[model samples]
Target: MKAKPCENILGLAMGSEQSRLRQQLVAASMGMVTTHVLGVCVQLKICDLLRDEPLAISELARVTGTQPEPLRELLIILASLDVVTIEEEAVALKPSGRLLLADQTGNVVQWVQYAAEFCAPAWMELADVLLGIPPAAGSKRRIYDALSSKRYPAEIFHGAMQDTQVEISATLAEAIRLNPGEVVADLGAGQSSFLIELLMRYPNTSAIAFDRFSDFTAMKQLAHAQGVAGRLQTIRGSFLDPLPFRVDVIVFKNVLADWSMEHLKRILTMARQGLNPDGRMYIATTFVHDPPSPDEAVVSLNLRVLTEGGDRSEVDYVAIAKEAGFELTRQERVAAIMILEFSLKGTA
Candidate 1:
């Protein structure tokens, strides 16, 4: 039987819509499983083991203390995800999987670990949080407080931050120019990777790394390893308080976005106080766009909201800086990061 044209068109549209919905459902299901599978692989150091060479499934199980059959099943799933390649019975890391190797500089293993352990649990409480109900297990403290109080693993958290910041810092180091003797300060510097990069690039310039809960020992070790220890100084203090030293350049990298407007204003005022009259301040962060785009920055904004902070737009940032007695001189976008250069009202 020949169907009428409108009926055939409607039927085709319905079929297409059904297929789309089915794909969405399948993807959602796979996403959940993939996160857990990757987490288990990281915990077992599977990527690290496969770094040097591929190993037979049985041998991998023997070394990682797992049942060979179950390990093989996991590897099959990893292969489906394009994270690993399975040849006969041997498993090898693909490029994506190699990014999880522990020794790789700026590797995302720590971030993945933290997300699996901490963020996943917190996200389960999203419904309750949206309803104004506190999480069942802990006080209503912010994520930063939990980190500062040692309730969460601070080292892993900071390592995750360092991992994410590595590329951004490198890009920033290349973008901003420094005079031979200019001094820079990195506020809320986690491991001071940015300052270390800057010092490496500008050999004659020195830097100060300031953060209240900074791992000075680890920072020193990293700086020494990079041969920048002699040029970097670590300070332990809150940015809300008066800064102890004045500098030619002050930077807040992925720092200011973690505070409220009131706190941002206060912190910027403190930065103004700590800047030399002719000094410049650079803020490197991810800004929310005026008309939101469906991207990772939006996902980051949601995470910040969960942590009791929120990302701001350039308009909001400029207004906040003005209120704190600074003027935005220039702005630049590098990948997902935004760099806002500011100076005192009349200094620029």
Candidate 2:
């Protein structure tokens, strides 16, 4: 996904009415003012408090331990966000919001919780990044850092990534087809969702989930959750360092985008050396860009340069893989995602 060229608006200095409107938009977007908003489940909880269905503001505030006035204001914004419906000023969670509140398939509560605490704070520094500040420097003052050390940040990051990967795991697992004893490793595999899904599909196969020392606890948690603890070996180290073994398959998911082309090449080079005689690799990226991040530019891509070491991109990743001595095997598209597979030059 190549980036579209941004059209610069010239002459906003002139008193053109269009310039004034654009200025207003820019101000609102930059947090000169904010529209208070709540997540889906948070709004649903308010709905539940209101009545058996939709409740009036007073009833909602009484039930949810929030002031009625604030609850009403929140509802107005939520209604506009489409999380709820207002009937004669009585607000209730919409169907989508109900799904968000569902515990099993939704998992939105975790997402919202993570956003409120984990991801939101660092985003506040995006402007700093744009002004040529690096994420490591931003991390120093990050609220997440204040809440926990490097270890906790890594844990929260892995958890958040896992939450994100949950949306694609089933489809990705379906796209993958590997044989028994065909070594597969999830390099930089944080919480092991990909490896776990692979193991479930190929119960007889063995695999490894590898990442930095920070990911050790997450790997353990994922291993326990997937019930693949015994078959799954956990490798705790940096991907830039030597890997323990070469495998038939290496998955680098949503990883390459955060990486500069050089860091990515190093990773591919290491994995190349680690690959078994017939090893293959896969890489994934999200072309989507999200605006309104707390303080960050390029929300999806900044994850790498900030925490790990890479920036985001919509460049042709196939070229990147090819340069690393890998050739195309398959391309899988699911929803807004694209998963590209590559095999070493000589491998099928």
Candidate 3:
């Protein structure tokens, strides 16, 4: 499993136009190699090793428990991907590589690891699965089953969810209105990172972070570290189960895009049933276009391989919400993710 790099045109001017074009094509075709190289570097904490100073290939290989020859080749590939800089047989971190550091607030290394090790493997079987030659062998199924079994990939999945929460927390906190003292529930909350962030930002707010998994050790520690443990409660149960308490806001962020239409409606109905008189429901997802662009194509394929369904337009979302006894009040786009707000039908 490896990431497929997007086409980069900046390096195309190094040779004649025809030759450059050919080079670009070759680079694009081998993008998976670039992704794996970067993933390996992060998994090995190579950037952390080189954070203070450049390291010779031999030293890096010794520290990472690898042979120098192959490690050097991987570092060279990373250099091409602008992840690291190679100088006279030594390597140092690049700015882009800094984002992969595990200590950084916006670190993407976990997401990259999940993409390369989990999602990419599923994607490799996309053509056969689409053609119905074999069953869906996506990591989604593996990860889903791993949760109950408490397996290793489940932790990787948690790390990936944290990465996504780190990327979208600020936008999500601002996009939806959260009044002080309001009770907010995040359905299918992974790691409860977003709820913890909101609790920090809105002191008077109390939140319920609900998910299916039995483990909440890391989430409780996170809330305690953020000094909001008293206000945030973790609930372990399936989203399909009936909710017992009513809340001011119910969020299904990044949750619906993976669900089948029937399950989506069921979840929406649960939200509706759990809402207070004037409560609001927020559904966030990345929608696909009718004529899917390259970016949308990747997203759609990712969803298809990982979940029961893929992305749908806002119109489709609205129609589905209506069936669940909710009315779409507004929709806003924050970067690439869409945040749609819904209210109980016939309510102000």
Off by over 4 Å in 3: 1-24, 132-142, 150-152, 165-168, 178-181, 200-202, 214-222, 287-292, 333-337
Instruction: Give the winner by TM-score.
Output: 3
List TM-score per model, in order.
0.81, 0.65, 0.82
Top-lDDT structure, candidate number: 1
For residues 1-348, could you state the per-residue lDDT of candidate 2 as single tens digits?
Answer: 321111222335637888777865665464411122444335446534532477777766676778777667667656655667778867776765554453436445545545645555555676765576655633732433443445334655565677767656666677778887776788777774777778878987888888763446756666688798788888777677778887888887776655557877777878778887677777765545444344434454346324544434434577766777878888877775677788888877
Better of 1 and 2 by lDDT: 1
Q: How would you encode candidate 3's per-residue C-alpha lDDT over 27-66 as one tens digit per residue?
A: 6776677558777888899999988899999999999999
lDDT of 2 at 113: 47
TM-score of 2: 0.65
- Give all candidates' CA lDDT scores: 0.79, 0.63, 0.78
Candidate 3 — worst ten consecutive residues by lDDT sum? 1-10
Runs of candidate 1 with Cα error greater than 4 angstroms are: 1-20, 52-59, 67-70, 87-90, 128-141, 216-222, 334-336
The order of the candidates by lDDT, greatest first, is 1, 3, 2
CA lDDT of 88 in candidate 3?
A: 92
Q: What's the true lDDT of residue 122 in model 1?
A: 68
State the weakest 10-residue window (summed lDDT) of model 1. Answer: 2-11
